[model samples]
Target chain A: MHGDQVTDKNLCLALINQLKWDAVCLTSKILECDDDRLRQDYINILNRTFAEQKQAFDFAKQHGWYQPMLAEQTMIGQVQSDTQKMVNEIQQSMMTMHQQAQYQAMPQQQNLNMGQGMGAFQHYAMPAMGHQQQIYGGSPQQYYR
Target chain B: MPHAKGKITARELLDLQSHLMLESNLVGQFNHFARECTDPQLRQMCESFARSRMDSFQRLAQHTNISPIQ
Candidate 1:
């Protein structure tokens, strides 16, 4: 179709799409930039483009040119629950790994005696372990006896 | 302003040149679209977009010391 022959609505819709593309391109440029100054400059431009794109989109929507379906509440709730569960699982795994690392950092003799008894090792290693914790800047937690 | 402290690289110069061109072209296109628009609201929106692009173009040109012509 000839450029001039396109209807106003079609032209506006096309401009909206072009703005979306511009936003994506600007985001990529910001991410790929190595220079701090250039990155900041791109970030500013991206922010302005985002605002303009939203304005354009709202204009189109208000005019009935862009009508998107509203998402179901149930779907949103399900996604929220799923995300929370995944986050909790990740945190549990990280805690377990951190405990393992602390255990490995302990003296081998203490580790061997850990299964049999706790009183002796606790008395022997407490001060040294406290020092180690200070050096590592990790909070001390009681080991399960 | 950030460009004041350090020298701009050759690659950065090229990137700024590209941005300036894009922004100027966008300003032209938006203005053209605004003139073609029959609805007052749509025309106003297009004009706003054109002004925004022009602002971006001027900002980049000012900061990078790269004129649109140069």
Candidate 2:
């Protein structure tokens, strides 16, 4: 295929590699277990898992999903770039979500500021001798005294 | 390299990679199993299993005309 053309098959294969790695890790952990009973139990589970995996592989083969590569290194490079693009898109979406959350929080912040303003008026403006005296119909100096 | 039956579909190519990847992983697991086993006979069995997996990996890689597992 062309260098820019990253087919679905390419992506699927790359992801399958991840599953292969998981199987490898599980097998290693199973082998490393010290208890004989536990190891045997793991082996039993692994056997069943392998059987399932084999079925899937067989299905792929039967459906013409497995084919040998003839000659094309461009596919590999295309897959790599496709993966990179996917990563970038994910990062961009995360950033957009973060910005959206911040935007959502701004209205609440403004409401908080409004509450604080009311608190300032109550504590400072109402308690001022000049203002209190004016309201009470007395001299500001007398009210201070 | 074994000649493919027809114009290989993208899906088939991907599946082939999956097969090779799994075989490579199975080899690694077998090697690990061999290392962890204390009994000589069990270790030998694990070692042989690993070898067989490697052989399978080589065959898969060969179909793709890629270098065998490192």
Candidate 3:
């Protein structure tokens, strides 16, 4: 059968369902058997059933109904590696941008430290304001100076 | 002459046989799914399931002294 014709998930499930029933029947038979030699015979039957199931799977894999597990794992590993690389790149870019921002702000911080009276005056010293406050504390007429 | 006693009890044998069958079925199902699934993630899931089933089967077989036919 063509690959496209056998790709149906339901069909595969149905096939597996049938196999499950067969396995259950074999299990029952194996459990009921008392003779050791006969038990081994039942075990053989079970193994044969399993082998047949495996063969069905092999056929499905050959027809491309499913992908090989190793190949799929390799694909997953590749995707994980790619995603990790992308995350690393993003982290690197973010770190670079942070560093650049810090570098650009350094000059401005130094400029502000040079007694530039701008924005909030927490760090800036108002020398003239200090003089006027001292004079006002002493006398109103001395406040003019 | 007296017959030699079996290494394991009948109940133990039944349990072992039942589990073996169950695990074998699971392994077969997962291996089938691993091979049949088109999606990479799904295929991986099936493959791991198959491996785990086989592992469980091996462990049980070892404890029960029942050699599984590979």
Q: Candidate 2, B3: how far from true, in Å?
A: 3.5
Candidate 1 chain B weakest lDDT stretch, 10 residues: B61-70
Q: Write the per-residue lDDT of candidate 2 for residues A1-145, one digit (tens) a residue.
A: 5687644333334333433554564477465554444345445545644653454344345546666567568988898899999999999999999999999999976765454435455444345554454454689667668
Model 2 bad stretches (over 4 Å): A1-145, B4-6
Return the interface RMSD of the candidates, in order shown, one decimal each: 1.7, 19.6, 9.5
Which order, best to worst by DockQ?
A: 1, 3, 2
Better of 1 and 2 by lDDT: 1
Candidate 3 docking classification: incorrect
Per-candidate RMSD vs. true structure? 9.1, 19.6, 19.0
Compared with the true structure, all predictions reach lDDT values of 0.76, 0.57, 0.63
Task: Estimate, for each residue in A4-82, the C-alpha lDDT of model 3 and write its tens digit.
Answer: 6545454455555655676676678677755575456457657755765675566557657656556678899999999
Kindly report which residue stretches of model 3 are placed more than 4 angstroms away from their true locations once superposed.
A1-145, B1-7, B66-70
Candidate number with greatest lDDT: 1
